[model samples]
Target chain A: MVYFDNAATSFPKPDGVYDSIMKAMKEYGANPGRSGHKLALRLGREIFETRELLAKLFNIKNPMNLIFTFNCTESLNIGIKGILNTGDHVITTSMEHNSVLRPLKVLEKEGIELTIVKGDYAGRINPKDIEKSIKKNTKLIVTTHISNLTGTIMPIEQIGRIARDNGIYYLVDAAQSAGVYHIDVEKLNIDMLAFPGHKGLLGPQGTGGLYIREGIEVKELNQGGTGSISHLLEQPDILPDRYESGTPNGPGIVGLGAGVKYILQEGLDTIRKYEEELTKHFIEEIVKIENVKVYGPLDIKEQGAVVSINIGDEDSSEISYILDENYDIEVRPGLHCVPMAHKTIETFSQGVVRFSFGPFNTHDEIELGIKAIKEISKEL
Target chain B: MVYFDNAATSFPKPDGVYDSIMKAMKEYGANPGRSGHKLALRLGREIFETRELLAKLFNIKNPMNLIFTFNCTESLNIGIKGILNTGDHVITTSMEHNSVLRPLKVLEKEGIELTIVKGDYAGRINPKDIEKSIKKNTKLIVTTHISNLTGTIMPIEQIGRIARDNGIYYLVDAAQSAGVYHIDVEKLNIDMLAFPGHKGLLGPQGTGGLYIREGIEVKELNQGGTGSISHLLEQPDILPDRYESGTPNGPGIVGLGAGVKYILQEGLDTIRKYEEELTKHFIEEIVKIENVKVYGPLDIKEQGAVVSINIGDEDSSEISYILDENYDIEVRPGLHCVPMAHKTIETFSQGVVRFSFGPFNTHDEIELGIKAIKEISKEL
Candidate 1:
């Protein structure tokens, strides 16, 4: 099947990731950092190595600041819930995913003040609006690197500068941009970054991570055995252990390491270029079809490889079903987990069908997908 | 390697568990419950089927009540922190794992009244003592089904009865006993049950679950996009969705379903009997060696397959290393993530080496492990 749902999860992960998971399970699947045995120690080192690789990729100086999580949702929840307290103000954007928006909404009911800056029709958020929303009570400014619904890249670097000037923590949700975008956390002054390993990272599901800059403290989301300081009942005051409290997804993390290795070897710029070519080719052809309207920044350089479109007023789910059953194409429909983004793009009720590209997607697949969409549009 | 660290994580999972994970990853790795494509729908059904199988195993009438977590630690944290409030009282045993004890300790500092009833040297808690500790404000009684450190079984049946009689909620941490032991939550009056799928269930790592009885409400541990109720900002008040946020660990849960299927086909009673025989044979032979002292209840019927022993006061880590390096037998030493249990068994500083048997373990491996320990004991 032609899978266009890379935004949901990148299908057909890089070649070595699956093998790495199987090898880790069979060769050294012992619980890491729990026992004083060779297998446990070896597995523990492997996890640490994965952390180091992530740190290097994100320009993080210390690897211990990266905490493995089940998904980007958990990482965002931890960052949002751990930092914002009662009576504190948080600044976010309309382009944010539900992961960030939902947590902030829950906190809003608990006396925390929330200000959502509106995104433009193209789904891009102005950095000046984020600065204008900031108040003396504002403690944090969080925004997504790229809008999942519109694929419009936000001005996180400029917003990060504003947050630093205001003495507020800056959090960037890189769920859509982690492996494909050139993200230097230090250059952007991002204090916290949350990302899913399965998407652009090309890893399996059940793997994600959060990178917290040093000197920033996020409250422990869940307290339990961290395999460190077991004698003390209190959660240990350590970097990663304080935030991580469980038997981590060992094989998943190992596979993530392999995925990262592949990305590093291929270079992020090269992969980004290939995906951009596919996105540009598809958008350039699909826009010529009658009654087809596309959302997000039209320029490939400004947006990600994700493009949302609608044929007349067709229901997104129904269009997606036809694409899958009749055309052998896999694309996601509806709100894409970002209800607010649909409202910003004027597709709240009639959601747009999304076609997202991955590193492995080719020119031929994009052309065929466009041809199928052209046929579907004619029928509509 | 002869793997005797089943208490940590059962090694060489049931035959079909790994294959199931691979199949799910290749065929149905789409984000379940997130999209409307055929792959997503098929995956969502697979996850629901897994939930149904788990419900049958635990006698849960509604499968929606069970929430899948990254591990048992996350499940215990959700149950512990979700229920207890300030000024409320909670009763737990001294033999509980750190997963339960650590969360309760954090809550204790948050103004919850915590009463840790001491257990005997045999690592068993008396149900009468638990009853004596209950107060009018007592809201919950938490205990581990089997101690990770000593393998002594807690009388959850009597504790459940006491909690019911006192109008208190009873939570059982079945980390080490879920698959091998028959746990009828309804029959035992268990209000909540937390267990790891990777242990006796013989699934891959990164899989575990919590079952909340009908009409019980526990605040969500992590709140984000649950695919359902996406239009609303507030977390949807739905079972499974309410407690489970983030992308469900699809491939890992599929492996867990396969593992549970194997257990159902083989019969829990048969699996339990085989593990019991292994435990008895290992214990009977190990006790015959000079200078070897064992902890926990000596009776096989009253305990699990895990056994903790020491030789002539030698450091447990040293003995475990010798076993792993010289004899190729994998065993866990040190606190085993249960520091309180070690203190209760009088091995606080000098922790005991733990030998936990699995369903695949044979009589020959146990005898060889026992002989290796005996030889090591003679050297000491």
Candidate 2:
């Protein structure tokens, strides 16, 4: 099957990732940092080396500032819940995954003020709009680096400058950009960044992390044994141990390290260039098909690999079903967990079919995918 | 290496667990519940099946009540932080892991009243003492099924009955006892139960779960997109989705399903009996050595496989280092993330060396471990 759902999670990960997980479980499966034995200490060092790799990839200064989480959603929750408090104003865009929008709404109900700037029809957010939304009480400016629904890349660097100019904390949700596109947290002026290792990093599921800048503290989201301060009843006041509160997914983290090492070896530019060619070819060919309407910027440079479209008001799930069963091509359907983004694109009730590409996706697969959609459009 | 730190995390998971994880990743690593496609739907079904297997093992009537977490510590945080409020009273024992004790301390500092009853010298807690500590405003009664430091089993059935009799919420942290011992939540009058999959369940690390009884709602600890309520920003008030807000550890959970299925087939009594024999024999031999002092009830019927001891006035870490470097045996020497339990056992600053056995441990390995400890004591 030709899988085009990399936006949800990348499939067919680098071979080293699977091997690393198996090696971790079979050779040294002991709990890291929870014991004083050789295997446990070795596992702990493996975890730290992974942190260093991530720090190098993201231009983070201190590796200890990175905290491993279960998923990008959990990282977002920890950032959103840890930093914001009552009566503080937060600025965000209408185009965001429910991971960002839901937590803000929960906080808004509890008396936090919110300003949601609208993204254009092409799902692009203006940096000036974010700056204009700021108020004296504004404590944060958070935006998704790339819209998951339309793949429109936001101007996070410009927004980051605006946040710095205002002395407010800037957070970039890097769910769609971590390993696919280059992210230098230090250069981008981003104070907090959340990313999923399973996606662009090509790691297995259940591996993700949050990078919090020094001097910023979010209230602990989940608290327990960090394996550091066992003598104290209170959670330790350390870089990651303060925020991280349990036995980390050790095997998953090791696999993630392998994935990131592959990325570093392959070079981010090479991987991004490959996916870009497939995405550009897809958009250029598919728009000529009869009665098909596409969303987001048609320019490949302005968007990530995600492409959404509909066929003459056909329900997206129905087309996706036909594509899966008859055409043997897997594409996602529905709102893609960004309902507000769908409303902005005018596909609120009838969601659009999403075709996302990965680094390993070939030109042949994209050609087959376009052929499948052309056939589906004719039937509709 | 002879691994004897199964309480930290069981090593060499029963053969099929690693294979199941690999199968999940290679065949269908799609994001479950986030889209409507063949792979995603199949994965969602697989996750549901895993939940059913866990429910069957714990005697839970509703499979949806079991929510998978990163570890048992995350489960405990979700339970403790979710159920308590300011001005409410909570009763707990001193022989609890920091997973339970740390969260309670955080809550206590936030104005929640706390009463920590002391365990006896043998690490046993009297049920009447717990009942006497209850107050009119008591909202939660939480305890560990077995102390991590000493392996002393708590009177959870009696405590569960008391909490039920008083209409208080009862939570059991079964980190050390799950999968190796029988735990029927319904029969024990348990309102909530937290367990780790890596310990006795023989799954990989990063897999654990919490079972909340029907009709009870704990505020969500981590909130984000659950895919079902995409139209609304507020978190959906659903069973598993309410607490589980992120993309789950699919491969790990599938591994956990295989692990739990193996336990169900092997019979909990058989596994418990094997570990019991190892623990009983280790204690019987180790105590006869010079300058060795063991903690916990000597009876195998009253404890788990965790055995803690120290050579007279010798730092446990030095001996553990010797054990690792010279004898190639793995034993944990530290606070074991349960300082209160260590304090109760009179090993606060001088922590004991912990040698925990698993079902796979053989009589010959125990004999070797005993000989190694005897040699270390002679050097002391």
True contacts kept of 1: 0.69
State how far residue B66 of model 2 sits from its true place (Å): 0.6
Candidate with top DockQ is 2
Model 1 chain B, poorest ten-residue lDDT window? B216-225
Taking the tens digit of each residue's C-alpha lDDT, what string does model 2 give over B170-253? Answer: 999999999988899999999999999899988888889999999986988777778787878788999899888878888889
Query: Could you tell me which residue pairs clash in candidate 1?
Result: none
Docking class of 2: high
Model 1 residue B148 CA deviation (Å) reads 0.6
- TM-scores, in order shown? 0.99, 0.99
Q: What's the lDDT for residue A230 in model 2?
A: 86
